[model samples]
Target: MNLLNTLKICVIAFLFTSLLNTTTQAQITPVLTHDDALKMILASKKHAELSDVLVNIAIVDAGANLKAFIRMDDSYLGSIDVAIKKAKTARYFNIDTGKLGELTQPGGIIYNIEHSNGGLITFPGGVPIKNKNGKIIGAIGVSGGTIEQDKSIALAGAKSLLN
Candidate 1:
């Protein structure tokens, strides 16, 4: 009888622990809505317009999946792929693409890392989109402009979440 009671107590404890873990996981994993993606795109487009630069902007969710995209009128046709890869690259590694580029340079810590992951753009213009709590929820990538312009535009998009 004592053993039976002990086993029952253990099962109850395990169930309680599982419920708490599930609740904590749900709380930590925030949901990203379509409205959030549109906000980023609009902010990036506005910045690109101000800079007189035509570009393609891409957004990827935390899972490194494409969530949104915008190609400015007359933007470079080739930039569409570049923009998408930039967003994926940023979200996959959870770091800005420019910073990742530095690590992938010759003799760097992660040399040729870009050659992996079905091809990643390790250059500027990819910025990780973080929530107000500084948790990376997604990423933004801008292309069709100079590296500096792309980076600035991408930054503008990421900053939209904060504003």
Candidate 2:
């Protein structure tokens, strides 16, 4: 009788531990989906059209992997890589590239930091996408126009995820 009781308690504890682990895993945050990434690119394209600025847009997941990209007709070819770098930079740093640029000025604390991380685009146009809990899930980067224009378009893309 004593052996049976011990065995039963052990099984119950094992089941409880498994249940707790499952619940914890379920609470993990989800990454950006393809649908959300496409929506972001579309929003950025619309903004670029309205501003009459040809641009390249890139979106990366939480892991900084490219998920979606678009180059407007006549957009500069060089901007394709720039857009990707910007998105990666934003995700890696969890901050807008524009702000990062400021921090990398000659006399700034992170001077020349852009030379790191396989080359980062520390200028404007890279924005981190955050969830309702204020956690960053991805990033968007826009290039090909002026810095201001790129930043504007990128902001539009990032904001779309909020809605």
Candidate 3:
């Protein structure tokens, strides 16, 4: 009878501990809200305006899902898909697209990788947005501008999360 009671107590303790751990893990996983994505898009637009360049901006969650997007007046229609691809590339790889571009060059480790994944923009315009814990929560991409301008604008958007 004592053994039975002890076994029951152990089982109950194990269940309680497992439940607590699951809750704690859920709380620690960061989720990027829609408002956060909007803030990033707006900030990127502001930066693009300052540069006198029209752009298409896109934000994607950590799962490479599009959350928000905008195309500035006079921006190229072709850039719409590019912007989304960049954001997805950054989020999927958890790395900036600029660096990914370099790594995908001829003789590089990931050469020809861009041709896969249905199409990816391995250029300087996508950046991952990481939480305070250094975990990537999402990414922002900018297009319809020079690579330099696109990169600058995307950086602005990614930095919005710091605030």
Candidate 4:
């Protein structure tokens, strides 16, 4: 009787585990790949004057590797570095670095995050790219324009993915 009971429990456990695995797989969302990031950037460019803007756009992977970067002619030399920094900041934080200033106030956890990441740029041009499930998988950064303009461009870029 004890052996039979043990067998029944094992079968029940197996069925329960199988059900959980199936549920988890059905709910899991795949992350955006590098190709997806590039397509989003291209779509955003159609809405803006890419050739006219003197700016740099950088796209980085979750690990902060540069997947795609573009610097228009006559853009500021420093904008490239700044754009990269912003992209890294977005990738690491999974949020816009523009909000870092507010989030890093005297009582905020992000306050010290700036000091932690040497290359993090707390500015308005960086936007985190999230998967359909809202998981951050990459980031894009723009520089060489006004902060507001940069933010607008970044938003345009991110919005392309969803819309």
Judge candidate 1 against the unseen true structure and give its global Cα lDDT, from 0 to 1. Answer: 0.91
lDDT of each: 0.91, 0.92, 0.91, 0.77
lDDT of 4 at 92: 84
TM-scores, all models, native as reference? 0.81, 0.81, 0.81, 0.71
Tens-digit lDDT string for candidate 1 (1-163): 6999999999999999999988876555365567888998999999999999999999989888889999999999999999999999998999889999999989999999888889999999998988765788888999999999999999998888777
Using lDDT, give the best candidate's number. Answer: 2
Better of 3 and 4 by TM-score: 3
lDDT tens per residue, model 3, 37-152: 99889999999998999999999998889999999999999999999999999988989899999989999999979987789999989999886557899999899999999999
lDDT of 2 by residue, 1-163 (tens): 6999999999999999999988865554467889889999999999999999999999999999999999999999999999999999999999999999998998999999988879999999999988655789999999999999999999999888777
Which residue pairs collide in model 1, if any? Answer: none
* After superposition, candidate 1 runs with Cα above 4 Å error: 1-29
What's the CA error at residue 109 for candidate 4, in Å?
5.7
Off by over 4 Å in 4: 1-29, 50-52, 105-113
Model 1 root mean square deviation, Cα atoms: 5.6
Q: After superposition, how far is residue 144 of candidate 1 from its true place, in Å?
A: 0.9
For candidate 1, report its TM-score: 0.81
- When summed lDDT is taken over every stretch of 10 residues in candidate 3, the lowest stretch is 24-33
Candidate 3, lDDT over the whole model = 0.91
